[model samples]
Target: MLTSTGKLLSMGGKPRNKSLSLPFLMNISNTASKQMTKLRTLQIGNVDVIGSRFNGQELHSALCAEGFDSHHLVWRKMGSDAKTTEIDYPFKTPMNNALKKLESDLSIQSILHPAPFAIALNEHFRAADLVHYHLLHTGWFSLLGLPLLTKNKPSIMTLHDPWSMTGHCSYPRSCDRWMTGCGDCPDLEVIQLMKKDNTHGMWKAKRDVFAKANLEIVVASKWMLEKVQTSPIFSHFKHHLIPFGIDLEKFRPGDSEVARKKLGIYPGNTVICLRATVSPFKGLPYIYEALEKLSTTKPLTILTLEDKQLFKDYLGKHQLIDLGWLEDSNLIAEAYRAADIFLMPSTAEAFGVMAIEAMASGKPTIVFEGTSLPEVTFAPKGAIAVPMGDSDALTESLRRLIENKELRNSIGKEARQLAEAHYNWKTHVSRIIELYEQVMSEKATKANR
Candidate 1:
């Protein structure tokens, strides 16, 4: 529970003090410290974490509210609706055009789309005290930008997904090729969609980039930390584990019956909510497979955040309610509250923010054993985690929960407790502040030298 700052206070609590310690000195340290120190700001660059319903929004907003002078450097401003200033790079180079054509021709992930306007962005680079880089595969940032970002300021890159460490795919599902050097990709055509394999070249390019840039890594989950540590590219950097946090007040428990009524679910119906976006790795099919096995006495209404047509082929028998990609967090929270159980059968999830949102709403969530879901939700206590791709286990778990109301209530209580204990936005932002302090200290130390 105690941090380094806490240890400082703990040491201060005792009688042993420095010879220079004085009440007057302490007041000056607290009061006039801000004026004494030059204005400090962290320049945050990302593809699209700022102005969107993305997982990083809460942390970004919280930092801004805490008087942190933060600016978001984005590409195209994908979601300009969320609260944040998105400064986009408008210039393009011939190399950028060539890379764009190459990306289309090779069916590669954004390899080197946006060429950095070094001359144009010189002022930004010089003024920034620190750089916090989020997702960079969005055609806005390139492997080349790493050198520029790390040249002057301390750069912290948050590992939101495995893309930073991998060759091509964002979530390399069971593919260890990324570790050794991604070649002969298991799903070559499926993932890369190329006649000729370029995974080796891709992996080598990223490895070279990491070698060129000095970056501090922050993993959002323990699972992510383990996976990223295996990469030779990132092995040499400083790594920290910091889970994504949620707004507790907005996502708290509400009346299930009221929520169910609002969502138009009839009484005696067991509701299951699936909020997976349209990604193959998200594993939406597992939910459908599980549903095919369940023959419940209670009417089963499956609430899907995605398009209903995605499940139309399989969910033929059951009642399906599609909210169709919610932008409002309140509505999403209501849907979570309305559901008796939340289903996240993802084969590969980095942090599972949807699962966190569901748990924060006091719902008993179900996820696969592998990947970050189990660790993020605190399995067996906060949520039920089954073996990966085991729809039968998921079906049985759902059946047991539906049959036993007491078990559901107890788990829901534990889930809410887990949300408070770990996933609160306040806790996440405080840790970020700690990291920022560490970065500033290093910067000051280097400057003094």
Candidate 2:
């Protein structure tokens, strides 16, 4: 039960069947949650995952639906659909905030300075039964604040990238400096930092700082889970593996003919899909080269969510359907339905959620065989796993899908079935709640002793 001051109280002193009309967030520090017989969770993230369309937001909304007091404390808002009870990190000034963003790749600055976001957490941190922290390094929230904020609390940190493991880089591709100790940084220039490499000290600081806190870990993919096991710091803690989930209803199969008509795509036109930032890891160049080799006898269009200017150089007279950035689920589903095949030829991914989203929309996906893609794609059924970074292989996969309508439709049907069977929101959230219950139960037992 929530008191007038937004604190959690044991409901044994209160009545059952009462509607919780209190605001979603309540700061219940100093209230002692052990007295309560029921479980209440506190999920923390850098964005209102419920309002946003990211995979993390999907999990946030699912948690809210399960009756947990879930809230996303964000540093910034991208869209204007404001959610209730979000605690924004207090920035000192507009210019200072912009300059600080440049150091996002390194946690060295965070170790030196303190963020006001930690102040908010201190005031409200102890209010929940267990706290779950998600992807934080987005120009705000400091990793330096973690040990202090989560000290002695039953908290869980979900590893989204290797940034926490390494001194600087998020995805340390082909780098094993993080294994022994992060020093003699190889990706210094790529980090785009203004200063020299202090990766060794930065990594050492995280080891020492995090050692003080009682924290659990969660990884979204088997690849990431492997990293956790090998890492010197993360290997010491308990962890869980929870893959992402998508909304089946919102991303369900739509009328392909109607969708194509709506998008102004004429009959006999083959639509190919690509999504990702203009990064090397996402295989943008592979997508570019593969499309260049595609047979052009039939009218072909590249359906992309990124703006035209971003891919202006790559668009060599090829038909382009640019939707810019889409936040609405229905519009994304429309794009998926209008397309003949979805291609995410990336070498790296942490449980590719967008690939599943395309599959859930009944579109046959094509991906490179590496990282979390193979596990997530359900290849030969939902998607075809091609050799990573081979444009010829990608072209062959795309050609096979475009040439045979029956094969494409068959793959799409299996893709939807795969999504329905394994990637539904309910099953994913239930597993999360199970973890929550186990953590809280241990806490209760500890308190009794």
Candidate 3:
């Protein structure tokens, strides 16, 4: 039981006061009844992960599978030539384009078809309901749509990264300037020609809007929740810690020999794999350093589906087998099975989804302590966590696993069990439903009074 002020209320105990509190007891009974009733919810997001080849897409699918009326509102950027919708160029589409499209769709739908947020909020405000928003501080969405959706609606915002909490739109671990309100930004010239003064103003505006939103802030990791709680941006909002989930059925253990054969690897050599989208934050440089230190005797293969040129440039004289982009889940699962250990040396992670995916595949994961990596991979029997940025520790941990097959098998089995218990999608979705019920019942009781 919980009080109206968000504190836990005691049950199964004698009343401390002389008053029996019939009204309070009656309220609790009525709240329980309201919780059992099914609810219709609206989920607002700028990206759709189901059809896209990204983690956010996978998260969207998982939430939809959990019985929410989840609809993804994507941004499509308008072009200079509005008439020319088709493009012949082979250049990768910019993210700004996507955000623009989402805004346009939201505007159009609210007037005619009515976007999910507008329709759901207008219809369900008096009923048991919730509005879940993903990535609320991505500039375009926050500036245009967030104010409209959150003005009178009971809203929850999930922080996918620390961009919203900080003044810098991009993270600051790589650059020192972002730590102190993001003036003289390194990426400013790349994005647009903005004066340092203008950038500071923009960041302040964003921060102010976020502070006044009155949102229930949901963080994917405890590390993130702690950071948000300390930060000035979200210190006032209610915080909830809910980690993302993985599909265990799609990422389970399989025959190593068969998996290796399918990937055309030799029958004898041990495999060490790293799966990431060739980004600097993923710490490809550290992996290269560790591999170079272990190259002489380990005879290990490093497999990734990232850029071949970038990997080759970072790892000179070291061999890296490029698998290219893998869209199929089964093939990815087989690749995980073929590997002896999964390596991730990320400098900063909101939550290490790849690490959990590897563990679900019954493979022991090697991650660094600090950040969200330790939080995700702290299962003692399942993972080996080394100090962050220490190549020596990484090399030693990898060498131990390479030498001992029994230790590897033991850790791998434990990792799979941990994944089944905590990282499963079903478990996460159930918790979310419970939270929704609890919050909605509280709202309903307050309204009746």
Which of the numbered candidates is closest to the native, going by highest lDDT?
1
lDDT of 3 at 185: 60
lDDT of 1 by residue, 334-433 (tens): 8988888888888888898888888888889888988889888999999999999998999999898888888888998899998887877665665566
Pitting candidate 2 against candidate 3, the one with the higher TM-score is 2
Q: List the residue pairs that clash in candidate 1.
A: none
Q: Which portions of model 1 show Cα errors greater than 4 Å?
A: 1-57, 78-98, 106-109, 118-125, 190-195, 313-316
lDDT tens digits by residue: candidate 2, 44-94: 665663335342455555555555565444444444433324453456456
By lDDT, highest first, what's the ranking? 1, 2, 3
Worst 10 residues of 3 by lDDT: 81-90
Give candidate 3 misplaced runs (Cα > 4 Å). 1-38, 50-68, 76-129, 136-140, 174-199, 295-298, 312-320
Q: Residue 214 in model 3: shift from native, Å?
A: 2.8
Q: Listing every candidate in turn, what is its Cα RMSD in Å to the true structure after a full C-alpha superposition? A: 5.4, 8.4, 8.6
TM-score quality measure for candidate 2: 0.83
Best by TM-score: 1
Q: Count of backbone clashes for each model?
A: 0, 1, 11
Candidate 3, overall lDDT?
0.61
Of 1 and 3, the candidate ahead on lDDT is: 1
